[model samples]
Target: MIHPVAVIGAGPFGLSTAAHLRARGIPVRVFGEPMVSWRDHMPEGMLLKSTPAASSIDAPQRGHNLVDYCDAAGIPRLVTDEDIIPVETFIGYGEWFQQKLVPELERVRVVSVDRKSGPGGQGGRSGGGFEIKLDSGELFTARAVVVATGLSGLAHLPVELRGAAADGPTPTGPVSHSSQHHDLSRFAGKELVVVGAGQSALETAALAAEAGAQVRVVSRGRGRVAFGAPPWEQPKLRPESPFGRAWSLWALSYYPQPYRHLPAEARHYLVRRVLGPLGAWWLRDRFEGKVGVREVARIVRAEAQDAHPVLTVQTLGGRTEELSADHVIAATGYRVGIAAMDFLGHELRTQLAVSRGTPKLGAGYRSSVPGLYFTGLPAAASYGPVMRFVCGTEFASPRLAKHLAAAHG
Candidate 1:
């Protein structure tokens, strides 16, 4: 008898892991809407930050790449790092990958995950495996659990903007996170303020202005917004990494397993800073002349005045001023916190050894809690920044699947 493994997400990592596991003849049940984040959470006009080659979802079988999807779907294939892939195209590719590779994926949400107990159970550890509860109230057991949900519940709103309102930032409220908006066009003919200098903030500001909204983009730090050089201008001497063309990035991209051997502080610093907050080379034209930018500025105070949000900003030269908008979008980016994974039972959360709110992963990306694993952003702290991108699936999925097959076989 074989007990299936439970994959909790249907994104690139989840789909790829399930595909690899199935190839190894492992029983698997995957849950969550296919590419739901890309389809519903991201704004309509947004483009992928990753290049064409970097955006393809990994599969055990050959010919299931984005180029293959394009060939099958009759769309033009983006063949190089210079070619920009649209978010819609990427989302479609992921869904197509799901259709081809993980047809057994369940669309229900997993409400809770806990250790299976009773006969031969040691402490809260499951003797027969783990129990999974779905949103539909169905319960089942799996030999192991792999968490690959990318960026869910990890949106970070700066404390300065968060303390402004009584109810705090909400999707419908005066203040909202960039991840909360699916369409910035709803703010058309309205005053919009975007906080942070990252790709999200710049793109949101540009898109809002394009939709005819009065837009003001604020850089959260004391520095101006930045962009990568055009593809042609980039030097070709350095080896290529999934994120960019550099030695550090190349190591991170291809040699992620060794990242765990580095010092804890060094690992943490690299994860936060590498591939940090900059727009793609292609977004320059759409952003530069179209949106107003406030550089080297900080939002010192925030308050919801009546129904409108007002910000007290301090600029580089110590100048202070008030700025108000119909809505404030915080593009502060995401921080991985394992505690935010509320669907995981309290006991599992407690038993799992963690560092800085993330699972302390060993070889095969296994957490201290046996049979439980984490991937994607949650694995970045242990594996390095490469895990934050779609291309990391090439390394993470097959490796974990082989580890599981050997462990259980």
Candidate 2:
């Protein structure tokens, strides 16, 4: 039986993978709301840390990039490497790319994916395909599945501020991650404490302040909040890329596959540090004096006191202080792990090898479970840090599609 390949997401990795599979004449089905995470999770007025050239979703064919979309949409096309990409524009471009290349995307939720029992109910452990159930009550059987559910179940919230709430514990709780808020206007007239010094944390603090919220950033790390240096100051020898201007960035960008050969400790280290905490260069001016930042401070204890969060913090000079806020936002970023994918069956997830909670992906991004693959951030462990960004799709989409096609054929 010739079964269609399943792409379990509609983000950059999912759409690009489906497009490549279709281009190669492999039957494919893609599920999920296109750019839903970006559209609903990020705050308004946030900008991408990636430059225009590296922000395009990879498509197998020509004329399907961010620049192409800008040209067709008549927006001022970003030409240089210095242009800051707005998140809204990027979301629009993603929708455009989805329409142009993978219009058949099913904008529905995939409720569950389990290994199907075939013949005498003994095939799941052998070579039986997968049973995919959709929220709309539709079901599908696919010979192969690409689990590219990007950052869906991976938002990391620190434990201390987990229960604080400006209103109360609702759908998202009192203290929530930065990914939970799309509109910062709701934060207006509220006191918000944004934790972390990363781009998301810094930008969210800036957005919250601009939206009329009294905001302060609580960074526990010793490193000061940094912005990418001016383009003119950058050396021509290394050049610039979205991941930053460094030899390691070049190595990771051009040699992701070989990166897997390095010691697991090294690969993991690079993944955590390569594109480490820093705000976008343009956001620096707005954040410096306008937003209050607490550097060299750590939250030693936290508690909720009457619809607010009270944080006990230790400053650089061995000083303890208390800061209260109506709401606390954890900008701690995402932590990718196969176990977080609740839709994936427990048996299937357990059968796959794991590294740092992420599925240990093989060549072409396949998992230990045959015919099951993972890409994007989940692939970062085995492939390198590049897989964590949208630019990695240029390498992953075609390679994964080719492997799946060959295996199917």
- Among the numbered candidates, top lDDT falls to 1
lDDT of each: 0.86, 0.83
In the range 1-409, model 1's lDDT, one tens digit per residue, is: 5678999999999999999999988889999999998898899988888887788888998999989999999999888878888899999999999999899889999999998774676322346678899999999988889999898999888788875656756877879998888888789899988888778888888888899998888886733688988777777998876677789888899999889999999999999888887877888899988888877457898888887888988877889998888989998888888788999999889988988998999988888877888989899999999898899999999899988777665
Q: Give lDDT: candidate 2, residue 265.
A: 93
Look at candidate 2 and give me any clashing residue pairs: 164-174, 164-175, 165-174
For each candidate, give its TM-score against the true structure.
Answer: 0.96, 0.94
- Which portions of model 2 show Cα errors greater than 4 Å? 118-126, 163-173
Query: Distance (Å) between predicted and true CA of 246, model 2?
Result: 1.5
User: How well is each residue in 275-314 modelled by candidate 2, as lDDT tens digits?
Assistant: 8888877788888887888875577877778756788888
Full-model lDDT, candidate 1: 0.86
* Cα error, candidate 1, residue 348 (Å): 0.7
Global fold similarity of model 1 (TM-score): 0.96
Off by over 4 Å in 1: 118-126
